[model samples]
Target: MTGERGRGRVQAVAGVVLLAWVVLFAAFVEVGNPLVLLATAVSGGLVCACAVAGGVVTMRLTDAETAARLRHVFVVLEGTAMAIFYLFYGFAFSVEPVGRPGDFAVVVLLVLSVPALGALTLVLWRSYAVHKIVVDAFGPLVPDSGAGVPVQRIRVLGTVLVTVGLALAVSAMTVALVTPMYRPVLLTVGLFVTLSPVVLGVSLTRVTDVYSARRRNVGNYVIVLAASGFAVSEFASGAGVAGVLFGALVFGAVVLLVIAILVVREFTGEWDRPWREPRGRKVSP
Candidate 1:
């Protein structure tokens, strides 16, 4: 199928099946527990939102000839994932008789779905925006060997995301070192603790866009793994004096130290060269 028609077909797959799923759910299921009802409503909303967003972004792909490969990728990932997630929720909650094991499953799904869907939404939307800019500027002849990244490569969105990740990472480390007694900033620490993965994921993905293929994930891996270790230390904060002092403070500082060493290693070597030219700093391609 042509890209335009394919876009339409993908949207149909999302909208039609989702609408039907909601119908079947309402007709057969009984929600005696308020929590189950809430889970159902929230999950339904999330599934629909993700599907619509993925569809909107994928539809833009048809505007750029070079975007065909991207269209295929998004179609398969979004359509199949949303469909499967919805079905999983459906069968898991249908409750043959209702309310036996929902407490744990509901908690797990709710916690996981936010990041899962949010990450998926961000990727699709950003890809479309990038594709749209290139199609507008250079008539879709952009020579991209992988994904349709434009030559000009002006990446404001990516820079902002990575900057936020750095800010959160620094703030979390600072708050821990200053002691948790600074409860006012505890929320910020919690944010870093929870959203670090998403931040790191987006940041690293953006980092790769500029780096040489072989070295793309090297420095990013150190940053992400250190951040994750630091975040996981939060759970031990309740273990008393030793916990508060050693859990986040000592461990976090140690991880940051390791990160510093790795980053220094990344920058000093020629292995990490061919980095993206910063704005106005022309590099021979």
Candidate 2:
């Protein structure tokens, strides 16, 4: 399918999903005992709907100028959603009288917000405005028809920082899960996890279109790193520190392999061409 058509389908699906979530939250509100769960679900659904709506609006812009304006608006909407999640659940997770069910819902919502906001920002900015800006401003920095060496170096630095942060956070979470005395440490770890994505999001937006090939490579790396962190946290919680370390090592290895593959692809002329055909009007990129 064409990119525009695919985007339309995705927006439609997002709308349908948001509607279903609204209905589900409404039903739970009427029948559930824990008010916190109902409130959290309802708020989360509204935020998601807002994000989806922003995406739809962004997709409607056909020109680069209009798209840039819409992208700015979308970013503001995303920031608002992030603010709401941080203020509500980030603060309430410890003090709220919510039961385990409500607490689970809160945690899930917080996690979902990161990717939902990330995807929204990506779709909007990566379309044209941000892409053109990076391409025009840093075109000389990018390698000819390949992943730029400078961009790759920056990505490497980002990967290292993200890896270290994830490691420390996961280690803290594991200890908290295994020992009741470390619960405060776990809370701090959760805060770190929440903040890391926010920082990554801002950084990514600033460098969204630095190099098309490197963008995909960097995104893939981030995903692997995040998955690894989750695996380590879960394994540690379920088994022991040995299990967590082993899982983390495995994940780290997989990410390293992915990085190697990306680097090889860059050098082997595999990523020398545009991944997608340019469409509409060229905007000086």
Candidate 3:
């Protein structure tokens, strides 16, 4: 479709611009004593830009349901690429006893290639499963609109995954906080756990365009608060206990606030009415 092609073009241009920015920034920092923190921040910005571009491209090229399923894949790839690139650069330039070429190659391949492949596979599987669900559940209601029908199911599943992943990631962070110094096992597990929530959270946000805008806004607020608190906690003393506790409190408060808002909206007719439509109606998916 012409619309899809236009969106793809926009995404490609945005992605190119972001990649260029990242290269320029990295080069600028290379002249100075490159700090790991600076590298990470810059890399993170690039990753975010890439994620947005990927989402836009996916949304334009695929159906809404397919895009929802692919959201996690794109997020994971962007994050993994950013992390691997930043770490490689930092370790090579800053850390003493520079890693061997083979070792660096192996690490880069594992971090970038494996995760990219895994995410792509997972997206394909989820998409197929969502397609089947839509065909079975809403085929009669909207005979030709396969894409819209699967969107709701995708959203529900994505939200559930994100919530579960966040809980696990929090648990992992608790362990790391208790341990203080980074053990290889704990660090690796913590990183994976953290990434899980990130990937799933992005997917949830993408699917939310179909749902309650209020819920989406609340969720975004919670995510930002939680992320900022967690980042701040890393700099705290006392093994970051105080920071962790503060972050946890914030997260809990946000969760409670979101629930309250949802409850009030439900009772006050502020909630969207799509869920109330007849089961067989051709409501927005």
C-alpha displacement of 8 in model 2, angstroms? 8.9
lDDT of 3 by residue, 35-109 (tens): 432444354444434534553545454454554445445434443443333333332233111233212233332
lDDT of each: 0.42, 0.43, 0.40
Clashes of each: 0, 0, 0
In what order do the candidates fall by TM-score, top score first? 2, 1, 3
Per-prediction TM-score to the true structure, in the order listed: 0.36, 0.37, 0.35
- RMSD values for the candidates in order, in angstroms, are 11.9, 11.7, 13.4
Full-model lDDT, candidate 3: 0.40
Residue range 1-285, candidate 2, lDDT tens digits: 146435645764675576465446445433223443454455455556655666566456565555545544554554454433332232223222234332234444454345444444443443333335333444422344333555455455446545654665565455455555435544554434433533443343333233343443443443433433433343234344544444343433443333343333333223233544236623322
> Which ten-residue region of model 1 has the weakest summed lDDT?
145-154
Residue 182, model 1: Cα distance from true site in angstroms: 19
Off by over 4 Å in 3: 29-33, 45-49, 52-221, 224-285
Report the lDDT tens digits of candidate 1 across residue range 128-201: 44444444545433223222342123133334434554655565555545555534444444454434433433
Error of 3 at 108 (Å): 27
